[model samples]
Target: MRKLTDFISESFIWSVGITRPKPGQERLAALYITATLAASILAAMTMFLLVLHRL
Candidate 1:
């Protein structure tokens, strides 16, 4: 019975932490994704302009 109770308590704490995203983690992820997308778009536009100039 004691072991079962301990197991349940540990599981609850683990689930709570795992289920929520920390604010800093969310912000970091957003910044990383935004930067990657912006870089990709800039590269694509540069390539397009270069191709147009060649033709």
Candidate 2:
């Protein structure tokens, strides 16, 4: 379980093309990724609703 979380966070950081954070900073990196994903999803939903209302 622990290793899985580490791998996921590391993969996220790598995919984002950012430098590997220090050991203590992994949590913050994960939080930043989560916030970014959430914001993108929210923006897409808002845009979809606006377009749907035009019909």
lDDT of 2 by residue, 1-55 (tens): 4555566667777787778877798777666666677688999999999999986
lDDT of 2: 0.75
Compared with the true structure, all predictions reach lDDT values of: 0.58, 0.75
Error of 2 at 46 (Å): 0.7
User: TM-score for each prediction?
Assistant: 0.57, 0.63
lDDT value, candidate 1, whole model: 0.58
Q: Which pairs of residues collide in model 1?
A: none
Error of 1 at 49 (Å): 0.1
Angstrom error at residue 45, model 2: 1.0
RMSD of 2: 3.1
Worst 10 residues of 2 by lDDT: 1-10
Q: State the TM-score for model 1.
A: 0.57
Candidate 2 positional error at 54, Å? 1.7
